[model samples]
Target: MFNESKKAMTAISQYCGNRVDYVQGGGGNTSYKFNDKLMAIKASGYTLADVQPEQGYVTVDYSKISRKYDEISKKMDIDVEAETLLINLDCVELLHGMKDLRPSVEVGFHSYLQKAVIHTHSVYSNLLCCSDEGRDNAKSIFENSKYGYIYIPFISPGYTLSIRVKDEVIAYKAENGKMPDLIFMESHGMIASNDDYETAIEIHETANQMMIDYFNSVEFPKAIIKKTSKGFSSKTEMINKFIVDFSADENYFDTVNIYPDQIVYLQNNLGKTILIDKDNASIEYIMSEKQAQTLEEVLLGVVYIITEIKRNELSLKLLCKEGEDFIRNWESEKYRASLVND
Candidate 1:
């Protein structure tokens, strides 16, 4: 058990760490089911990189959560959000070494998956996911894979998304006699899961490579930073070019968001902390050093997705207006965004 926990912690950090831009700030989660009932998942407000062998994750009775969803999911009168919050809290195990932390909000879906699961907002996956032609493109791109993939249409996050995913997985399993290794959520991100950690990692990396090779995408560029009186400015050519190309369009920022994490980090900062320095062909953010860096990564990610979509001559499938409004008003996302500075 101890060794499994340590391995899970290490695997979580690898996806969230510097080796790959799989996630930014507190945007993604990883989980490992220790047994039929107990599962370890990243805490709600902590980035995956903060997870360690003894802290930054929580153990939950995943079977209980899964059962509760099955029982209540089909009922029409339940207050899903409130019920889900209560159920999640109740399922948390008061374990010895685990921190007293709230599990990631997407735990509902995690409980339904295999032993090892990684959910990331990868730029490579989003290149196909955030485009209007993404669904068809995904079908064509991954058609020959040994392990088939599942593409989920855009669904609001939280319990609802979990339910949707559960249904899809159930349907897929019925036909294929097993779970899919890769699940792609449109306008969101991807999930790679397997019974073991190493295989799960391989599935994720291979899926990312497939997309990158298909589009011939260059490596995502790093932010070129310079100190400013209030905060920091990005001199990255790609980021600057994006601002220059779309600064005249009033709706560009709102429409350019291809994933939920982008809105979580950038929505509040825009026009306040984040500013366009068109004169210098740079992007500026008025915040502390830590906050500035966090925002820079997210902004760079957004621009990277846009540039890739444009470069491939693909039509962008942006988040709808309603989805943007929901994310802006979501308290859970607001809490996660707040952790960026801490």
Candidate 2:
């Protein structure tokens, strides 16, 4: 089963990497468990398409980590002491030895799953997660689906997310007498699994298609842009403010650039409603075709914005449903290598 599962992992990785809507660059991870003793997972910083059975895949001993943590905690009297002991336990050494690769931050979540786990940052899933309305829309789509779906709110990756997933899975099993077939992370993506490789892959693909179908059914309101030079500076300022508020990262600062689409979007509708006082001199307008196009793409697209702050790489990604325009956009097609140069 282990060897077969390894092959399945490689196949799934390739499938995900090949589909830009499913994964881009190093955005997703996959795993398979042979038994209580060993599990293989995709390595960090590697695309699924290039992963070979022996290269990007890593095998680690799960029993060792679990046993070591359990043993150390039982011997410790204080919770603080137990946590400190667990962090420094030899289990860390064992993890480090697993191809010297950093395991997925969601490793704990995978450990609790069955023989195989496929975590993908699919565009459709992200689109559904980003908006409050989108979440409800997704729930409605899967209301009567055969596969169990669980939605978990966004949490920063690492131990916090891993522990939350573990607890949620446990709670779900206790309540329903079964584990969910898929876990949807709000503002993130999804984790899916099954005993059979084909079944797991099918579930993921079908679920994504369902969401895409739902998104396509939505009638987007047309954006009407109004031209005004006085409003441009003010609109840019407002956009900058919105970006800062949304990200709350100092690194963004004044470096945020409002492209032509954004300018058109703001000058059209927002400029009318928002008052332009001295302190709030920013002009507002409605959405523009370009902005609408961009927003539509963002809702249905997989975008990764790589920024450099003080020479360090800062990549901000928005994984959402790919809009029709985006799919047909020459620039986007080129980026995905879906179009050939003449």
Candidate 3:
């Protein structure tokens, strides 16, 4: 039995570590209930690669956290009950090893989960959460599927996200006669559950592959350059010249593959562009006519320059690489197609 649990932990680590889109850093977490009294969960700030059967994880008393929270909430006002429960239960100590390690901010949500749980920030999934088209695409993808899922709009992570999920699960169970098997957070990723560890992982894998297959069928426009100048100019010449003069490197002068929304921005007049920052503040950028070339060039250049300038970096090389990757494998294009077909 001990060996089986260790193998399960190892398998969970391998699954999460292999997918860059699912977890780049220590961004997601997994857990399994050992029994009614105990649970084993991935430790905080440690990459899945670092997790083994013996290192940097915790076997906490599940009943303790639940019981303490229940007791504290009863004595506290409703408005402050959750907060009081978290502190009084000593939830912070549940994170084993590394005294400084903080339990996952989503612990509250995890506490209410069943036997096994898997949370991920998969790129394809989160992209679907970012816009209306993506949301609808997700709904249709799982509409009649055997694995039931719940979708929640954008909400802050940690306490707020947990509360929202808990409330949604309760309402869903009341209306549908069952709790969701999976949960999708808008602009975030997903949480899946099953009574068995392997089953939970399989469910996540099945859903992930379905999404990948859907994206592979999408057709994005190939990068093409055409020159209207009546002088001695070829398509390649125009494209090369455009890259040399505008971009940081000629090698990076690739294609201008824009999504529907990006096309709108590219076709807009050349001048200052408005963008929203992480803090929700508006920022403006002034672009010269030289900066905006062919529609594709404009699209690539604008994105490259924006990221570069924001990071105060010397070059936009990485930004260009990201754009190339997006054109080659972007799920947004598939999502856009899904919307049109719907």
Candidate 4:
């Protein structure tokens, strides 16, 4: 039994890590519940494709997480500001050799899930999640299908999103008599959780293909991921030119952000030579080696996600000013971005 899960973990890591389409940057996470008292989850800032035993995941205390979540979440419901909740989040305990490691912020929902969980930033799945009519379309498609799923509208990642997910799962079970095996997080990606790794991966695959087929039938634009980044163009002139050409709209700030991680990956780091001052409605060209590489790494994702949005011609969902401010200020997110930047 232990060996099966171990092999599953390694396979899961390799499968996800080897594909940027399934997992990008430091986004996406995986977990396995060891028992009622403990669980092993992908540590923050690590990729699923390259995990190495306990080195890749931190085993957390479920009992401690559950207790603190209840406490902090209850206060979050009453408190208007999110600061106190952030401080209280530290209450969730890490076990054994994992104390120094940071757990994925999704631990709340993972703790409430099955023995195995696999979440991905699959681009094909995002074809549906990022669609304008995605929720209604998903309902029409999966409502009576054999696979059970719940459509959650865009929620910023972290305690708040998990709180909603926990409640949604509870309500789904009450209505459908089963844990939602497939959860489509609108404007984000898909999440699959089940008693075993294969079950989880299979569910994601099924839903991902369903989304792919659905979008394909509509004659969706081709997925244009550049498989190799070894020869990516980092010339300041080229980077600035693309920024001006692609992100020149007057409403750029209001509409350009497509994912929270984009902020983590690009917000402060992108366009060292080109800067967007939101309040001033301006773009400036500066210079830096760190900035060039940072922009190169995250620039493609930004361009692609936005390009997909335009291709669909669907009323899009962009990160709001408040949401952007919140995520950019987060020290944890900054740290995660630094891992990639390093």
Candidate 5:
């Protein structure tokens, strides 16, 4: 069972992992359900590109997780995060022997989805999802497409997010007679789930392209990062221009933030990764090459989303203060960031 899932995880990771625009750092989770009882998902703090056919994922009793969601839904005043984490821990298949690994915090929602699920914090999706009219624009963008779509407003990640998504998915299935293939979460990102790996990838690609075409948006500008003795520096025209313009504003990144990954990778740590020398109009990274690269991608992505949103005259939909705080304190996100920053 793990064999088939491992193959599928590797395939999907190879397909999207290295695409910086699709995911930066360890910001995405991919999963494959081997059957009704067991499913394999990416481990916490690991980048998709880091996944191989034989490693980088863990198998869990998804059926148990799905059942637990149903049980929790009936109860009142439950500690959603604590309850969900314990449930996921209990459902882990110890026989497989990845004991130290933790399933993605999103396991609850994945358990109820199709066999193959790819969730990405894609910049293309954020162009629409990070705008005030995101849901309405999404409806019009994918309106005539073959895939069924659902929109979830911004919410807390982990158990709270998963439960909300579960409700929406269940309601969608009831009315449409099938689960939705495309899910667009406001101030979050997009999810493409299907019965197989190829179709899931297809749905994700097609939907992102649809959003791109809808906005008549150009491709993101190249992020030119050059290594230096101290670390790395940004040479891209767009990025340097952004730095020159917004360097004076200390909270600029937080203001332009369009999604959770922006918070996790940029805003929270501030100048730890990329150092902005406002006096000289220079930006330098003081972290590892991989961490520097991740910061560069995220920095450029945030700038790109802001540019496109402003060009289209759509009101920016920044992550709320509550949302920002939640992500700031999330243990799972901290672990993921630690891996990149280490």
Candidate 6:
């Protein structure tokens, strides 16, 4: 029954995976819904680039998720007891071919979306999401956009964001007469979903193009580099606080926590880069001098992105404690990280 789905999904995954401009650090998830009963989602820590139609995804009973969210949604918006509310369900794995394989943490939102959904953390999308006028700019294009669009404020990927998306989707449909084809998540990524696989990919491409064009139409302040303490350089003072001299023995990145993708890429090369460690990561470093230099460039990119984030005065998403937990404990991501380009 899902033969076409497998073919479609495989085609789209491979198509998008091959583009580093779209799926970096395996930080995206794609899924194809097979009836309300099931969906095959890209497994956690797995790159869409490496996904084979039959071997990579975890089949999940998405209907079960909808039911659970419906029940929880009623009281979820209640602010008073939000902290005390308890809603727990057993580990529901109706069919995960590989026992250890977990679907993307984003599965919750995908289940609430269309039959086909592609979510990617493209740098182009971030140009709008992270710019000072990004939301306004994106909203302007969406106003005249050929496709129906929905914009979500920055909410990290989790049940909370999923529930929010579900609610917004319902509201959008009620007002616009159809579900959104393009859902732009602030400071995160964009989701392109449709009943047709090819259209989903098309919409993602189109939306990103719109964003790229929008950014091109506007001028951005260049990231100016100035000498800083301990042989570091940056455009922002807050971010510069974490960087220090390259150390042969100490992990300087330990004192700071950066974005999710940065954590993944810099894990092994912490020591060699002009260190700007944060969040007291305290993880061990294992990269050689060359690896450290390469990672330094990545960190510099991070610093520039972060500077833009601050310059926009946008509260872009950053990896929190929970996100840090996943990068450290998840073995699958560790392997993916070993190969992911920044």
All candidates: TM-score: 0.94, 0.59, 0.57, 0.78, 0.92, 0.68
- Residue-level lDDT tens digits of model 6 in 214-238: 5452232233344443443334332
What TM value does model 6 have? 0.68
- Residues 293-318 of candidate 3: C-alpha lDDT, one tens digit per residue: 22333333333323322333222112
Q: What is the C-alpha lDDT of each candidate?
A: 0.81, 0.52, 0.52, 0.64, 0.82, 0.63
TM-score: the better of candidates 5 and 6: 5
Candidate 1: segments with Cα more than 4 A from true spot = 74-78, 248-251
Give the Cα error of residue 98 in candidate 2, in Å. 8.6
Candidate 6 segments exceeding 4 Å error: 73-100, 217-259, 263-269, 272-342
Question: Residue 260 CA error for candidate 4 (Å)?
Answer: 0.2
- Model 2 per-residue lDDT tens digits across residues 1-342: 345766887877776766656664345788777666777777544556767766676666656644444454366465533342243233332333235654543455676776778888775676655444555665788878887878886654434456678778889889889878888886567888887777888888888878757655232222223445432222333233444434522222212311112121222223253323333423332333333333223212322211111112222323222322222332312322211111
How far in Å is the alpha carbon of 182 misplaced in model 1?
0.2
lDDT by residue (tens digit), candidate 5, 1-342: 367667887888777888878887788889888878878888887778878876677778998898887798788998766787888878888434454578888888888789999999888888878999888898888878898999899998988788788889999999999989999888988899999899999999998888889898878776778889998887877777766765733367756656788877876556665677766666788777777778878888888788788889999998898998888888777767776765
Determine the C-alpha RMSD for candidate 3 after optimal superposition of all C-alphas: 14.8
Model 4, 1-342: lDDT tens per residue? 345555666666666665656676678888877668767777776777657664676666766665666677556345422442353345344554544567776666777777888888777666667667778778867788788888888876776777788899999999988898888887678788888788787887787777667555333222222212322333333234445666543245334776677667655534453455433333442433443444443444445555555566756666667777878787667778677645
Cα distance off (Å), candidate 3, residue 14: 1.9
lDDT of 2 at 72: 45
Order by TM-score, highest first: 1, 5, 4, 6, 2, 3
Model 1 lDDT per residue over 111-230, tens place: 988889999988888887899888888888898877688999888888888989888999999999999998999988899999988888888888889888999998888766779886
Residue 107, model 5: Cα distance from true site in angstroms: 1.5
**Pairs clashing within candidate 6:** 253-277, 255-278, 255-279, 256-277, 256-278, 256-279, 257-278, 257-279
Residue clash pairs of candidate 3:
none
